[model samples]
Target: MLFQVGGQGTRPTFFEMAAAQQLPASLRAALTYSIGVLALRRPFLHKVLDYEDEFFALLMMILEGHSLRTTDASFSESLYGLRRRAVKIAVNKDNTQMDSGDRLRLSGLEKHQKVLSVAFLVVLPYFKSKLHSIYNKQREAALQATLWGNDDASFGDVDYFDGGETSVARRGLLDPEASNWTRIRKRIEAIIGVCYPWLHAGNEGMTFAYQLLYLLDATGFYSPGLHALGIHVCRATEQELMDTSSRIARIRSRERERLRGPPWLKALQRVLLSCIYTTLDYAQTGLIAAVFFFKMMEWWYQSAEERMSAPTVYPPPPPPPPPKVAKEGIPLPPDRTICPLCSQKRANPSVVVVSGFVFCYTCIFKYISQYKRCPVTLIPATVDQIRRLFHDM
Candidate 1:
């Protein structure tokens, strides 16, 4: 949808496009199938592709070694203009000659400028932020659905609208459970590929191209930086998952070249990518992390309680007769513009129903994702519990 919004023909399927490029029909069909399958699993590809300028800059840096520097330094700081983006207009005010208010009113030019200014400055950003939030929630929901067998739950499953048998039956090593029919198809393709050199390159090239893009974070700036960093860590930790006796690992270790760079570089990556990046990426594992942390905390508390011979859930919350409650009600309600937690004007107001507290959405969510507690109340909270507070005009 985002890609469509960017412009039509933005997502030209590889089938017809490859054919036009003079690729063999078979290869074209294969690539189209593969990409179509990829789209179904990862629908956000459109948004990623929508921000083409950033990717183009990165590509030029990699391929051409230099790129033009523009005001749009990063994708997050998206530029606004009349071309494609919303246009900006400045409202002029002059009290000198006949004035411009009440009876005098704004001039036709001023009125149009004000409307355009509000649309570009306010409407553009607010809508984009909401869209981004929705995209992130979709991802978090998909992850939870996978881990907790909640595919049947409201979270929904990874869906593909269309795909060929080859793409669906096998996503190569990414899907180890290739059906028997898919295996037969692979064998047939391999035999034909041997006869036609272009077929071999064409088929392999499609997957390789997609993999390369995925590795380089093709949608780099649009996504959270930590996700790309975590992936690099996983790539470095490849050998961690291999069994000592695994045939492939043994073969590679025995005969292949392995470069051990500097000890310092290795240590740096361990701390930077493995530790920090991986922890931030764990925010996606919303439910899983919550369950895991409490389980560990419970075990520790039980051990401590056993030693002390105390009977309780574990260590209690804060020592309290609890904060004293006022018997009388306040004269006025809390400030709507200011966040209770931050004691500042809210930018993106969100509410914590359990604690009856309001805060900036990002501030509260990041804190909750990290500590799983409301900052003010120290009460348990989850990302799902944060409700966006909207005002109707």
Candidate 2:
């Protein structure tokens, strides 16, 4: 059966679970883009962006660690009215499928489960990103080596993206042309080339399968990470969600009753406490609204034709006519095959469409680019008007 909001201890519906899962990733992507934009203005932010995976991972570690410790939910899960619980299987001594033989208990996760989950959420992704980057570097180096075929290929010239050489072994291996390092690098790259795709595919395939199974109600865990840690997300009861707020209000009420401060100070403190509580209560809802608003704006911009339509472009003005008196350029060579500019036999001949005169490709291109006119006829022209000619020598 599908779970509804406010249902205590009930498993959330697939939509809710999916929303919770997607929310964090969407927020992260938006944050990353924002950081990239800011980095353009702040040069040092570029360096920070280089280790963005680790930087964001550290932030997630703190946020998720705090959420898990206090509410047994990650920030996104909590925002979606869900909380994680440990799953324990129960079986009778005979190990039979009797009425009381097979049962499952849902409770708070153990200390180790929380720690491991935090690591999986924060550390694993950073390492995965780093590995993928390394693989790309190795693949590029391999391609460069192939292209440099038998030309003193410098297999070690490729720079590792993460702060140069990571170990002592790579310290002086930059000149591997004279040693067997090139062969070793080739063998290692060959192994990575063979294994990376399979590993990447398996990871993606397993994640998809797990999500599918969860959506079909065939699995308790929505992700492989959760399954490995025996964690299940369930809807938080209304009372549980309201407990902290009520506790805070009660404490504040007692303090108000015993207040010895001036009336204005007491009132100020009360207002501040109320504001803090209100902000905390509504912050998640506000964030969800903002994200949805941004997404709607993005969709509208992509699909709306009325907004910022391409401007019509007029054709460029024609180049000015040549002067008639002294002839704008030097006289053309009498021989048709000789270039007026280079004074040599025309090679890779090209014609200036505006002037109807042919010249060597290099000579005409340089002349039109600099002078913007035909060398022989002195007619105004542009490099764009030059056309290459291909025919039998």
Candidate 3:
């Protein structure tokens, strides 16, 4: 976590905080003043995109991720409302079964927001690199054009392929690429995102959710996204989801299973986390101002009391340990069979992390290698997701 300053990670060295990925201001709703202040002020918060290696950070992500799941769910509901509006704009008041499929697909896409988020996160840096290369070339061309007194020719006039020869495409994730393949890839990603939702839906959405939640500032995170989803959910009628496969019911059931605590408890945790986030926001914005204001207040109090004593406000109680783990380490619907693969008692129990479902260790490891998807969800996955589960009888 870089080196801590008085237990704060605001300023760590380059090597120490090496893996921490800094995100853009645009993602956090940069327009809002509240968000702006928080962004400007948080000196110690490294805005970590991935800190899975650190145990405390991992624990924090798990706690934060679930609390965020509630926030995300609320936000998803809001987004649907907006989508319904757009749909109405095209075909006003068309209540066909195909429309129901549209609602279901939209709902599914909203649920898989984290998966899309990861796609964007992975794409953006490469996109930036490509843009930078394009910009540099354009600048160099502009310079040459000006030097030759051909000022009429602009950077936009710069040719991509010199000597009219086709440039060979580069490969790999980081390579600067703009081609038909990118469009094809996006379409495929969209299909998977809507149909299957997150890669880790069972565990507080996907791994991407953690990054998004962390990237999203607490104060500014809620309103816009939630407003959009709320509209979609509110606009869709019971008949909208009722016409076909009962998709809403399935989605709701999955959500209930995903939540680690009771709904109310989970909501409370999010509320508290939001409050803490707000406090952090405040700290970030008026840090120096707060110190000066406190100094003046302390002086005034000292003068009034005719003494040199400092104020004696008791420190708040230590926060309760995060209720991250379940009471039994077993999922709810408690009496169910421990292994889904064999549908039997716990024998070599393991977890398929892609779907967050337990199975026989060997069964899942072998199954994932062959199928490359979670058996329960039928979602694409890899063998790396199979991990042993340790639960005492």
Candidate 4:
């Protein structure tokens, strides 16, 4: 009798179990006969069957003392071949199987065939593709998040998607997993480690080519003293530095020649070379700016300290103060000719002799500091020269 459930026959094959447990050793011995007989007669149903249910039914019958006698050798072989093919198809179609939660009761032959079909076609392939996609997506998301920042709006909303939490719970896209600060720090450290040697080796050609624009200030370069100082500082290790740079270049050339080989070998060499070059370039530019700025700050500090410490010498005797004029005798200029400094009618007006422009003494003094000449006529006048002219007036 076939396996029974609640007094009704049920499919005996279990997809999760090994073939030995689902079908007896006696049936295994007759597999060749049964397989052959089944194929020749084409005894199975050909409809769009629920294959897993059908597999369970056939497996149940085989287990329930249904034997293929050896006398019928070809018939047994056909049956065995049909069983194997059915199992393969069943396992491969595992993804389409109703979830365990949705499975329904089956009876006798139907139950047996369903289980065999699922094991051979459904369950196996389903897990393979599912696991593959899961890991592949995780790896891809990690790479994207590493290059570009996080994508999630919030971890709070991760569980709302229809396909369930698995979609967003994956760590790669999350903020905690994709830290830009950490990556930047690692990159900075790698750059410093790669470029420090070239800088320390005092490779002047490379250093000057890379650092010249940054070393001197734009305005200071116009001054002959400052320009000479900058050039002298840069040429400190002239001959020896040049020789060292030449040797390093020769070494790099020889290394490149030695590395040239087969396509794959050369490709690997170029990738490594490119990474080092890029890293070094970033390091050199940043480090040069930092070093030059620090040196300027140091020079400023030393100059300030020396000036503060230097002795102050007495100058020649101070000049006598100018005599004050009587305010009543001074004529006030018209309101339209207001003083530039105080923005009031010019009291005690004085004609700027160079331009014949009249203004308060205070206004003319303030204007002369900025222009060193009359604002109207553009005639040159020093403060002393203007003071002498005013005294004579």
Candidate 5:
């Protein structure tokens, strides 16, 4: 309705407007998740988290205020090459409305328009959220009364009430479910439900109507907030959005030409300017891409496979229990010729090199082969370390 006639130069596409809105929503979701994680580590952050809506409103006010002050655009709008301006309506000689051609050439938003636009952008969402939260709590309370009120109120049994004064008892049964809080909530809902539909319907109907208008000639704003505030987003012209670096380059160029600097210096300046322009152009897109990449990496690292494959450190096994060593060799009887291992007269005597203990050939051979240690001193001895001894009978 504000611009019934033809639109101004190059209106932004519907997708661009939608993308701008999505950026802030995505950022809010990410911030909420991050703050929840931080709340566990810092006790004071719990208070910040408790008043999340207010905290976010303050943050948006700062960001949007700075952006509008500098560039006449909100943070997201400026990123997408758009800026806000108040709608300019004019009357013709016959008191009929004129076309919007001249209106497009208007300078900027008026003082009241700026204040109202920012307030609507920040406050509308908070108001809507509080309304929905109240509705949810009321619904939950009503459900709890229906499900558990009888037990909570110390009723003996429904069957006991069925026999005596059926109508009176049935009425009393319903009484417990409608506590003072529930009755008050019901009354308030009834009052609002009767009177609020007209305003709510008008707002929604206007929003839909504006979308239709946008399709016709991109006349009205795409965002409901801007539409309600009597403002629209327009494609910012080059002159309006001149780069500061470009201005600096122009001044430097005049100096260079005046002084006749070296050719290489001019070429180097051109390259640096080009680099700066490219970085500024891609900065928003790159930031969004980087955020998604980090989220993807976080998801991948949290997967079950990553957890199972994670390495764990363990202490080394204790050194093999000192091998049960005996200081003296195996005890021998008065007869020095007895075999200590088999406890019998020595035959085919053998000596172990590791512990210098003597035993029967078969006994020492089997013991060294099976256990790989001396039977007397428990020293490490192998089958190859055994030697057969020869003596005269």
Candidate 6:
């Protein structure tokens, strides 16, 4: 009998097969006697019987060679080699299992250590560099703001061309309750609502950073202390509260610009100015305007008072009835199409029009289960109509 590892066709060596099988009493007795005699003649075989030691030594030699080849390589490259060897040995030993408990070969352990070391050396430094750059950019914005303030810089002077200087008192049209800055800030804050949380969650810090920069550009102001606080909060915590704070700050900056324009005009500008707004509002307001308008038709179901108060009405009157059809000149049909539901041959069969097509009563009822309206013109058909047709049938 032959023993094969993992049932592969390859047979085990003679010693492995001997170890696997339970020998008969006579054969076991003979084997014990033969082993004692062989042990006395070849004592060195017993000393060299450590299989694990030999395996480890071979693995170490291969690892040392690989280390030399990857001495100056990147963290990803080192990790790649380590993961590749680990997965291979793991598959070979554990038969395609990728569980954590699988015993890693000696080379795999050594590779893992090297990969961890490289990750620390490479990833940490790169992250530090990025952090430093962000810090410097914020500092520069603060310094610019300070310099501009010191120079007493103001928005360009508005020249009124009316030019009748007869002690004409000009009242500034500023509304403290809803200043342009406040309105803009509110709108921006609303928009930044999504972005702020993501940044705080650590899922999108880069995006938040860009948005902050955009805020600075739009508002022409900067608070280094606030920005620093935000950065610290974002980096130090992963909780929802911290994320909310970051989002609030981002939104505030955005809204500061929004207040400058009328709400409708601001919405329109947002629609026309950026592809982001276009992507967000497309289905609800753009090409699908008819659907949205229909959905927003609360006026259709309003109370009498509400209807009277409404500013506009729809489907304005026709421009004089189509010159009254002359009944005498028109020829009569041989017979009206039979109403399938009522079983009465009438002039007009009370056609159930839907999606530009007509269907008989029973056919329409069956179709209504799958569709809401007429198949031909997409007009809504009443259940009464369906029931009436069925009763007539």
Best model number under lDDT: 2
lDDT tens digits, residue span 190-227, model 4: 45545544543554454343334323322212112223
Report the poorest 10 consecutive residues by lDDT, candidate 4.
68-77
Worst 10 residues of 6 by lDDT: 228-237
Q: Which ten residues in a row have the lowest lDDT in candidate 2?
A: 1-10
lDDT of 6 by residue, 242-270 (tens): 35346545654575466557789877766
Across residues 7-30, which tens digit of lDDT does each residue of candidate 3 receive?
122222222211222212221222
TM-score-best of 2 and 5: 2
Give the per-residue lDDT digits (tens) of candidate 2, residues 72-183: 8886887776878899877776866657668888888789998998888778877777668768977776687777643432336455344344432464465555347757
Q: Each model's TM-score?
A: 0.16, 0.57, 0.20, 0.15, 0.50, 0.15
lDDT of each: 0.42, 0.75, 0.42, 0.42, 0.68, 0.38
Estimate the lDDT of model 6.
0.38
**Decoy 1 TM-score against native:** 0.16
Q: Candidate 2 at 299: error in angstroms?
A: 4.3
Candidate 4 matches the true fold with a TM-score of 0.15
Model 3 poorest 10 in a row by lDDT: 78-87
Candidate 1 clashes between residue pairs 3 or more apart in a chain or in different chains: none
Task: Give candidate 4's error at residue 142 in angstroms.
Answer: 47
* Candidate 1 residue lDDT tens string, 81-132: 1011112223344543343442311111233333343343234434444444
- lDDT score, residue 186, model 2? 65
Flag regions of model 5 displaced more than 4 Å.
1-9, 90-105, 150-205, 216-218, 243-393
Model 2, runs deviating above 4 Å: 1-9, 92-101, 145-193, 244-393
Residue pairs that clash (backbone atoms under 3 angstroms), model 2: none
